[model samples]
Target: MNRNLTSQQKNAVLLSMAQLIAAEKAVIIKANKIDVESYRGEDIAMYDRLKVDEEKIEGMILSLQQLIADVDPVGKDLFHFTHENGLKITNKSAPFGTVLIIYESRPDVTVEAAGIAFKSGNKILLKGGKESLNSNLKIVNLWHKALIENNISTNWVEYLNYNRAKIQVFLENPTQKVDLIVPRGGEKLIAFVKQHATCPVIVSGRGNNFIYVDIEANLNLALKVILNAKTAKISACNAVDKVIINSNLIAKETFIKKLINKLLKFNVEILGDVELSAFENVSSFDSDEIWFKEFLDYKIVIGTVNSSEEAIAKINKYGGGHSAVIITKNDKTANTFMESVDSAAVYQNASTRFTDGGEFGLGGELAISTDKLHHRGPMGLQHLVTNKWYIYGDGQIR
Candidate 1:
C-alpha cells in the first residue's frame, strides 16, 4: 500500500516532476530509443505504436509543465447554499485518496495520470502494459526522483513491479486499498478489469468513433472533416472508424466520386455497403460488424442512411460509446443528432478526432472514457477530483 500525501506535498511533488521532465529531455529520448531498439523486428504496428521519438518526449514534458501550471482542481467550491432554516451547506472538491491506473502501451499516460492525480490530491499506483514497460519504468523513475527531491512521500506515486499474476491478484483482492480503478486500453483489458476489480472501475473502452453526413451538409466541408478525422492519426482513439452518409446525398454521383478519389489518394481502404457499390473506386463490406470495428489503420467503413434519424439510430447501435460527429448545415439535424447519440462526446461540423482532452486545451488526458458513470469523455485533471459537501450551521439542526 502507498502512503497518502497532503495536498501541499502533492503540489510540491508535481512541480518537481514538471521540472525533472523538462530538464531530462535527453534522458527520456535515450530511454525511448532503448525501447524502440528492443521492439525492432516485432509487429510493425506494435513497434510503431510503442516507439517514442524526441518530438514526443518534448511534447510529454510540455504537457507535464502545462498541467503543473494549471489551476489545481481540488479544494474548489462547486456549490454553496443556505436553507430557510439557516443551515449552510457547501459542496467542494475532494480527493478519492488512492487511484489505481492500469493502462497500455502509451508511455505518455504515466505523466498525464501523475499530473492529474497530483493536482487532484490523490496518491496514484500505476500499472502499465508490458509492451512499454521499459519506457514506463523510465518515466516512473523520473517521477519518483521528483517526489524525493520535493521532500514528498515517494509512495504517493507507486509503480507496480509485478507480473500478470500479481496484477490479477491486485484486481481481484477485495482488501486492496484502491479508491478507484481506471483501466485505459482495449476492450479486452477494460472488460477484464471491470469483471475482476473490487474497486470502483472506470472502463475507458475502445473508441470506434463515427461521423455522419446528412443531406443538408456541405459536401466540401464534409469531405475535409472526414479526411482529417480518418487520416490525422488512425491509431488514436478519436480518429474516425466509420462514416454514415445520408442516402439523399449519396445519390449525387459526382460528389461521391470526388470524395472516393480523395480518400484513395491517401490509400484509405473503404468498406461500403451494397447501396454504395456503384462507386467503383472503393471496396465493400457486409453487415454492421464493420461499423463496430476500430481499424486503427488506413481503413474506413461507410454506410448509407435514409434520414438523420436513421443515422442517429445506426450510430447509437454500432458506436463503441466514444465520439460521434454530425456534419450538417441544418441546426435542427445537427442538434438532434448531438442529443440523440448516447456517446461520451458529440460534435457538430467538427471532426470526431477533436474529441480529446489535449485538443480541448487540458494539456493532456489520462484516457478517452466510454463509461458514462464516474468519468466520461476525456479524463483530465477536472475528472480526477471528486466532490464532498461541507456543512457549517448555527444551533439550528435538522
Candidate 2:
C-alpha cells in the first residue's frame, strides 16, 4: 500500500514488463495450461474462461507489444492559456497515482491492465478471481521479475494475494492510497464495489447488445451480420443478445426463413412473437421478459418493430447500454438510429461483436463499460490516466 516510485521508475518497470512478456511467451502459455487442466470438469462458462491455449497467449503478447508501441498517454498538455492578469493555466495528463483493478475469470486482463498502467505511469494493485489464480500468479510473478531486472520498485505492480476478506479490506482500506478502483467482473462484484468503496470506482458493467434489421436492409447483408454477431462466440460480452426485425420484413417471410435456417444449423434457439411463429424453428415467448433479458448464450430473443422509432425505443428500454447495431441501406434511417439510440457504442452495417478494443485499434481493452460517466465504450491506456492543471505566475496572487 506504499506509493514510493518516481515517474521515471514507473516507466522503466513497464518497459521491462513488456520485454519480459515478449521474451517469456512460452512460460505464460505453460501457466495458462495449468489453470485450464484444473478446471476441466467445471461448467462450460468457467471452462471456457479458464482455458487459454497458445492462441490466447499470442494475442496477449501482440496486445502488449501494440501498447508498448503506442505513444505514452501521460504528460501530454490538453490545454494551455494565459490570462490578462499574467496567470498561466495549463491542463495536462497525469497518472491517477495508484490504481486498484479487481477482475474475474479473464487471466488476459492481468497483462492488458498492467501494460496500460505502465504506459500511463500509474502504480497498480490487481485482484484477479480465484478461478484463475494459478494463471494470475504466474503472470504477476513474471511482472515482478521484470521490475527487478530493470532496477524498479516492484511495488508499482502489486497483486493482492489474499482471499475475499482481504479483497474487501483493500477496497475499503480508507488509507486513500488507492485513487481509482476499477472492477471488471460480474454485476454482483461491481455492485459491491460501487456501494462499499470510498475510492472512485469505474464500473465496467455487463454487456447486453441488440441489433435491429430495418426494412430497407438487404436480406443477404442482414443474414451475414446476424450470423456473425450471434454465432461468432455466444459467451462474449459483445455478442448479440437480442434482435429486432421490421414487421414488414417478417411479412415477406423470405428473410425470416433464411435467418431461421442459419440460426438452427448453429443450434441457436429463437424466441419470437406470433408473427414469427410460422417458422418451424422458432418458439413463441412473452415479449416483456425477453426484451429485458441478456442471454449470454446461443439463444436470441426476436421482436417485430413497427418503425425505426419503435426499434429505438426497444433498444433503449432493453439494452445494457454497451453496444447496439442497425442494419439498413438508407442513410437517413441509419443516421437517425445512431443518434437516437443511447449506448456506449452504436453501429451501422456491422455486427455488435465488433465492439472490442482491439477491433477499434486500441491494442486491447481493459473492459467494455456500460457506465456513461468517465470511461465509456472500449477503455484503453488513455482512459487509465486523468488530467491535472499547472498554474504559473510571477508572485501574482489573486
Candidate 3:
C-alpha cells in the first residue's frame, strides 16, 4: 500500500495502455470472435454482453484516456482543522487498498473498470466470467505490459482466472486483502458474492427500472423517451423494463395503442398486468413474478396506476431501485414523483438510459450501484475511495 506512484507515472501507464489497445485491436477482436462463436443463443442477455466489437474496443480506449485526463482522485484533502488544545487533524481521500470486481460477460469491463481502479490508486482484482476468458486474458496482458513500460508493478491490476468453485472459496477465505467487492451482473451473481464475501460488497444490482406516464404527459415525448430507453440498448441495466401509466391519462387508450405499435416496431414483447391485460396485442403477466424480473431482453410490462401516490407505491414495491422516470409536463407532478420514487437515479421527462456513468458525465463506471452505503448511483473514478484521518500532536494527548 505504501508503493505510491506519481500522477505523471500513472498517466504514462494509461497512455501506454491506450496505445497498446489500438495496436492490438485485431488480436483482441479475434479473441472476442472466438467467444461470440461459442454462443448457442441459450441466454440472450449473456450473449449480448459477451460479444465485443469495434465500437466496444474504441470505448475501452476512451475510458482509459478519460481516466488519464481526469484529476488524480487520491490524496485530496477533504477537511483540515485545529483543536484549541493545539492538535491538528486532517481528513483526506485514500484508495480502498484493493477492489475486486466480479462481472459476467462484458469484456470491456476488464479495461474500463480496471482503469478506474488503477487511476484511483486501488489494486484491482478482476474476476471476469469464464465465457470471456480469452478476451479478458489478452486485455489484462496489455495492462500488465503498460504497467511494466511505465516501471510500475503489475500487481496494480491482477486478473483472476478462477472457476466458480475457486471464486467461492476465495470469497469465503481470501488469501489476499479484499477491501471491497463489487458484483456487476445478475441478481444471482450479486447474491452469491454477498453471501460469501467477508469484506464489504457493493451490489451493482439489476435494473428493473420503471417509467411512469402521467395524464399531462406529452404523448410524443413519452413515446420518444420510452422507445429510446427500451430499444436503444435492450441489454443495459438502465433500460426500462416496465411502465406504469396513469388511469386518468387523457386519451389513455389511444396512448396505449401508440405505445404498443411503436414497441412492435422493435419486436418488443409486451406484457401487462390485470389493468392493461384486456387490451389487444398485450398479454397478461405470468403471475406477479413478472413484477420482480429484470427483463434484459426485448420484453416489457405495462401496468396502470390511478394516482401519483399509487405509481410511487408500485415502483417502490417492485422496481430495482436503480432508476425511475416520470414523463410529465407538470413541474409539481414531476417533483413529487421524483422525490417519492426510491431509486438511485430519478428522472423527469427523460429516459432511464441516462443512468449510466459515462452518460451521466463520469467518463466511465465500475458499475451502477443500488446499495446506499458508500454510494447509490454510478461508481465512478471519484466514488471508488474511502477516507483517512491524520492527527498530529506534539505535547497534547486525548
The model with the greatest TM-score is: 3
TM-scores vs. true structure, each candidate = 0.92, 0.93, 0.98
Least well predicted 10-residue stretch by lDDT in candidate 3: 1-10
Say which prediction, candidate 1 or candidate 2, comes out ahead on TM-score.
Answer: 2
Query: Can you write out model 1's per-residue Cα lDDT over 1-398, one digit (the tens) per residue?
Result: 33445556666776677778778877776777777777644444456567777767776777777776677787789998999988889999888888999877777888888778877788888998777888889889988898788776677787886677888887888345889989987777888888888878877788888899889888899899999998887778788988888888844677777778888999988888886766786777666577788777888887788998898888888899999999989998888888999999999999888888888887788777788888888888888878999988789855
Task: Quote the positional error of residue 106 for candidate 1 in Å.
Answer: 0.9
Candidate 3 wrong stretches, greater than 4 Å: none
Misplaced by over 4 Å in model 2 are 1-15, 40-43, 174-176
lDDT (Cα, tens digit) per residue for candidate 3, span 1-398: 33587888888999999999999999999999998887666788898889888899999999988888889889999999999998999999999999999999999999999999988989999999988999999999999999989778999999999999999999999988999999999989999999999999999998999999998999999999999999998889999999999999989999999999999999999999897888888999668878889989999999999998999999999999999999999999999989999999999999999998788878799999998999989989999989999999998966
Choose 2 or 3, whichever is better by TM-score: 3
Candidate-wise lDDT, in order: 0.81, 0.81, 0.92
Number of backbone clashes in candidate 1: 0
The window of 10 residues in a row where model 1 has the poorest summed lDDT is 40-49
lDDT of 3: 0.92
